[model samples]
Each structure stands twice: as structure tokens, then as C-alpha cells.
Target: MDVLITGANRGIGAGLVAGYRARGAAVIAAARSGGDVALDVTDAACVAAMARALAGRAIGLLVCNAGVYVDKGERLEDGFAPALWAETFAVNVTGVFLTVQALLPNLSLAEAPKIAIVSSQMGSNMRANGGSYAYRASKAAATNLGRNLAKDLAPRGIAVGIYHPGWVRTDMGGAGADIALEESVAGLMARFDALDMARTGEFLAWDGREFPF
Candidate 1:
């Protein structure tokens, strides 16, 4: 399979690139910097340029993994500034939309295209922990976007799946997080491999459990 992954320089993204390569997939590892394709997902022009550059390449899988968690530990009193919210949402929400929109043609070239959105369980209203408001809200929006995209793309033979990649030991997830990068990557690959029209619009955990929105 040919896969295009964003935010693929490090953390879960990097691990995913390695895992897919090991499995013999042709991987296009895109990043904001230091990758096969340097792309600022937040920039519409940049996204469009990348898409045009890769116009005919068939992308069987598109993983929208670029995201920011700028308000991780910020308190509502003084932290979680307006600028931070905007920055986080730009990357976490708008970035995903732009990437998918720009790559639609490439995706259409494949026999069965799939989109995996690395959203978070924290986005679920049932899982609210009352902190990291910006991250939570942005992820929630991403999940919603993925669901709607699934509906719209189904007739076109493109499936969309949203997932929480677990609390991994990445730069954003921290060392104290529950799972290792390998574990999350492995689970996510499984989920991606199993993705199809029947499972489109499903919000799932990396381990293959269905998640509540």
C-alpha cells in the first residue's frame, strides 16, 4: 500500500513511518520540517502545492497526524491564551481539513483509499477531564470532521476513521504516559489495515476498541 503521513518527523508519527516501511509500504513522510516533504499543514497554499506536486501518486492511505497541544498544562485563570487556542486549532483542526482536501485527487487514484485521523479520546464528551481545553476542543472538532468526511466520501470509495493513538511516550504524550511509541504505532497500523467502508465514520481506539463520541 502507498501511505502518506503528516507530522512524520518524530513521536508517534515517526514510529508509524518506520512501521509502515518495515511492512513494505511506500511511505510519503511529510513534516513541517526535516522530512521527505516539508509541509506546514496550517498553510493552504503549502498544502495545495504539495498535492499538485504529488498529483498522480496513488495514496491508498492518508494519515492526518499533525497536531499541537499548546495548552497542555495551562490554567484557565491566566494560561490558555487566545493566541494559543488559535494556534492549536489551526494545526489540530484546520490542518487536517486542508491536507485531506488537497490530497483528494491523489486518494481517488487508489482502488480503496482510507483516511486515518489521529484524534484523541479526550475529545469525547463522555471522557471530559476538564483540562487542556484547547487540545480537547480541537480534537473534538477533528473527530467531528472525520465523521462527516466519511459520510461524504463513502460514495467515492474513500473511508475515514478517527482514532486515539493511546497515551504514548512521545514529546507531547510525555515519558509518564501509558504506552510506548511502538505499541501505539502497531495498534494504529492494525486499525488502518482493517479500515473499510463498513467501518468508516467509526471513532476507535488504537487498540481497535470502538470509542464513543
Candidate 2:
């Protein structure tokens, strides 16, 4: 299996890339910082060019994991960096849209393609709260985008799935999260192995349980 992970230079995205690579799966790691496919998820033209650059290659998995936070869980207009909110969504939501649009053609060449939009429970409309307003809103949009994509791509045999990585201990998730990075990612990959059209379009937790939208 050949896998592609956006934001592969750090955090869960990095772990996913490493996890797949360790399994001997051919991995195409994409990141704004460092990866085999260097890309800024927000740039449509760059995304398209990257996809074309990978043309004719097998891409069995696409981990749409690139995202951003509004620095300190703060929202613009009420915060110092007024532009932070838009920048957050640009990378977190719109970026996912353009990246996938760019990669779909390349992905169609795969035999059993899967697209996992690594999401979060902060996106849960049923559980919405006050903190991290910009981050929460963008992820919620990304999750919905994944749901719609599942429907649109079903005809092409591409399964689109969403996930909540939980309050992971990462640069963005702060230092107090409960689960270890390895544990969360391991559980999610196990779920990935069992997925098909039957279970696509669902929001899943890193532990493989379904999250209520």
C-alpha cells in the first residue's frame, strides 16, 4: 500500500506516516515543512502541482491531516491577531478541500483507496463549547466536508472517513492530554484496516468508537 499523509512533518500526521512506513508500505509524506511532497495545504495551485508531480503513482491511502489552530485558543476580533481566525480556517478547512481536489485524480488509480480526514470532537455540533472557537469551527466544517465527500466519491470506490484524535499531547494539544500518541494512532489505524463503504462518512474517535455529530 502506498500512503500519502499531509502535515507529515509533525504530530499525528507524522506518526501516521511513520506507522505506515514501518509496515513497509510505500509512503509519500506531504508537509509544508518537510516531506517527499512539500506542500502548503492552503495553496490550490501548489496542491494541484504536487498531485500532478505524483501522477501515475499508486496512492492507496490519503490522510488529510493538515490543520492549524488560532494560537492560544483565541478568536480574532476579540484577540490580538485579528487575521488568525481566517488563517486558521485557510489551513484547517479550505486547505483540506483543495488538497483533496488536487489528489483525487491520482487517488483514482489506486485499487482500494481510502481518504481519512483526521478531525476532532471539538467539531461535534452536539457537544459544542466556548473554547477554541476558530479551531472548532474549521474542524466542524472539515468533518462535514468529509461526510459529503463520502457520498460523492462512493461511485469511484473511494471511502472517505473522519476521525477525532482526542486531546492528544502534541504541540497544539498542549501537554496535559491523557493518551499517548502511539496508542491513539495505533487504534485509529486498526480502524482504518476494517473500513469500507459500509462504514464511510462517519466521525470516529481515535479509539475507533463513533462520535456523535
**Candidate 1 residue lDDT tens string, 1-213:** 899999999998899999999989999999989778989999998998899889899999999999888897898888988899999999999999999999999999999999999999999999998999999999999999999999999999999999999999999999999999999999999999999999999999999998899
Each model's Cα RMSD: 0.6, 1.5
lDDT values, one for every candidate: 0.94, 0.86
TM-score computed on alpha carbons, candidate 1: 0.99
Candidate 2, 3-45: lDDT as tens digits: 8899999989888988998899999999987888889988888
Scored by Cα lDDT, where does model 1 land? 0.94
Clashes of each: 0, 0
Q: Tell me which residue pairs clash in candidate 1.
A: none
Q: Given candidate 1, what's the lDDT at residue 77? A: 88
Error of 2 at 140 (Å): 0.7
Weakest lDDT window of 10 consecutive positions for candidate 2: 73-82
